[model samples]
Structures are given as C-alpha cells and as structure tokens.
Target: MRNYLIAGIAMAATFATTPAFAKDVIVQMKNQGAAGAMVFEPAFIQAMPGDTVKFVPTDKSHSAQTIAAMLPAGVAPVIGKPNQEMSIKVDKPGIYGIECKPHTSMGMVALIQVGKGPSANLGAARTVKLPPLAAKRMTPLLAKAR
Candidate 1:
C-alpha cells in the first residue's frame, strides 16, 4: 500500500507538468450545411497554439484560403485548392480568416482563433473590405474575438 501511494504521487506530478497534447480540429466545407448554402460548418473555431486545423472539402467547388489582411503576423499565408484537403498548424496567437475563393461572394468563410490572448491583428482583419455577403457573414465571427 505504501509503494502504491508513492507511485501514484509520482504519476500525478508527471502528468501535472506535462504539456498539453496538440489537437486536430476538422472544418468541413459544404455547399449546404446547418448554416445554409455555401458555408463552412462550425464556422468559428477556438484553438490553442500548436493545434492543427484540417479543412475538408465535403462538396465540389469548395476551397479554403486566407484573407491576406486577416492573416496573423509572422505566419505564412495558407491557400487550399478546391475540393482538396488542407491542414494548417496554429503556431501563433491571433485571429485568422479563411474563405472559399470562388464562393466568398456567397459567404463561405471561417474564423480561427489561436490561443486565448487578445489578437493584435484584429483591427487589421476588421479593415479588410470583403464582398457584401462575405462581410455580413464575418461580422458575427469577428465579434466573437472580443
């Protein structure tokens, strides 16, 4: 019983100091989803740094790419081909805006929040002038960052 207690304490300490495991989050691009037509299901994603976001094309003619003005500082731009799967690892803390190039006018967009820290580029992201429909869709997503 004494040996078991020591082992348990050691294990508890080990786990307490261990870093959180990175997670893989999936965002599906669909022509028709819970949100209606031309949408990325669960359009808003909250994640921590080091997590990976996988964009899966569930319908034809759907693609994923970063809105240059919404990109985080020091991070490379991500562009995904239509009907293809693309994965992006979140290494910095900020807000990232993703859109389906061909369908952006129809409001196919997604927002990724990496880390809980306030985004330094949120203002820049808000300044990007998207098409009417896309801007309307992004309004609420950006509101979540605050």
Candidate 2:
C-alpha cells in the first residue's frame, strides 16, 4: 500500500512539472506582384492563449506591433523591430491587431484571435482607427471571426 501511494505521488509530480508544448503559428511578411509589400500569409489566425505567433520577415523592412487599443484588457504589449523575426507568446483571450508600422498605410496587417470564440470587444476593435488600407482589409476579416 505504501509503495503504491509513493508511485502515484511520483507520477503526479512528473506530470505537474512537465512543460506544455506551445503551438506556434507563422506569419510571413512579403510582397506580392500587384499587391505590393503589405500582408501576412495566413493573415487570420486562431490561437489559444500561450500559443506563439512568429512573424518572419521574408521581405526587407517590416515590423510587427500589437496595437494597444486593439488587444483585450489584460494582454501584454508586443512590439517587434522592423526587418527582424519576432516571436510573441499570446496569453490573452481576445483579438490582437498587428501591423507593420512602415507599411500600415499600404495595408500590411494581420489579426490573431485567441480563445475559442469572438472576444468581448470585437465591435470596438473593428472600429479602432487604423490606416485606410488596414482598416479596409480588416473589415471583412473581422466578420469571419469565430
């Protein structure tokens, strides 16, 4: 009986200490022939809190910054330098607005929705002041949020 209890305790301890594998989503910044240099492949993503979003620069001079007003109440800020590969760990359940600072007017933007459904402030996020192009692009994407 004592050995069985010890074994059970050890098993529980092992599981508790194991680090959970995080799911990673890749967003590539590049230029299209006519579309110009403004977009994230797989522009719309649904990730769980704790998932990592990797913004890879395939073209030169692109940065990823999360608009503070676009995130949920408790989400930490995410800002990446231009032309660098930035990795963000999302631990908040809401909509995240990402944009390339330099190309925002040209419509380089993407959205990441964390959690299973639409966030509480979805309508407000859709109305945030964004660049003309970015705003236009998000209109349709926001409608498709789960």
Candidate 3:
C-alpha cells in the first residue's frame, strides 16, 4: 500500500512539473516580380513566449536569416531556402528581426514581437505613406502595357 502511495505521488509530481510546448504561427515570404527581392507579407508579427513562428517561402530564390542578438535569448529562427519552412521557438519576450541575405537592401525584412501578453510592438516604423490612388483610373493605364 505504501509503495502504491509513493508511486502515485511521483506520477503527480511529474505531471505537475512538465512544461508545455509552444504553439506555431505561420509567416510567408512572397515575390512580386518587381525585382529579385524577397518581401515579407504583413512585415510585423506578435506572439507570446514559448510560441513558434514558422517562415514559409513563396519565392524560389529567397531565404530567411535571423539577425544575431536581435531576438531574446534562446530564440533563434531556422533559416533555409525557398519552398522550405523554418521555425523559431520564442522562449523569452522581445522583438526579433529577420532578413533575406540576397535582398536585404531591397526590403526583404520582417519582425516578430514576443511577450507575456499581446502588447509588444514589432517591426520598423513605416516612413512613407502614399496617398490612395484611384484603382479604376489606374487599371486601364496598366492594362494597356499588357
């Protein structure tokens, strides 16, 4: 009976001390064909600690690389080629920046903000805001080129 009681206590302790794995978020990189540049859609992402962020490439020639020391400790993203997916598990709460090696100057960049809550701000501030152009007037002009 004593052995059974001890076993039960051990099992309960194990269950209580186990850590939970992080959840995954998906991010995609796209190529718009304007140039040989990698573009990250939505540019900014937010998550909590222990969350995993997966980077998916939609461009054939682009890859992702995490900026060293940009992220919190233990939060380094896996970087790879196009059509390949990599993930970063955020253990600490902070902002992280990722960029494509081939097109870092062409704006192939993204940012992830991880924290205890959903209040952390990630990504660089937008510097330019173009006025909304009339799509109806622009469509005919663009169509003529095609």
Q: Whose TM-score is greatest here? A: 1
Model 1 scores a C-alpha lDDT of 0.90
Q: Which stretches of candidate 1 lie over 4 Å from their true place?
A: 1-20
Indicate the worst ten consecutive residues by lDDT in candidate 3. 122-131
Error of 2 at 85 (Å): 0.8
Q: Give each model a TM-score.
A: 0.85, 0.82, 0.58
Q: What would you estimate as the lDDT of candidate 2?
A: 0.83
Q: Model 2, residue 62: what's the lDDT?
A: 86
Worst 10 residues of 2 by lDDT: 30-39
Name the lDDT value of residue 35 in candidate 1.
82
Maximum-lDDT candidate: 1
> How does candidate 3 fare on TM-score?
0.58
In model 2, what is the error at residue 130, expressed in angstroms? Answer: 1.3
Error of 1 at 15 (Å): 9.1
Q: Report lDDT per candidate.
A: 0.90, 0.83, 0.58
What is the number of backbone collisions in each predicted candidate, taken in the order shown?
0, 0, 0
TM-score of 2: 0.82
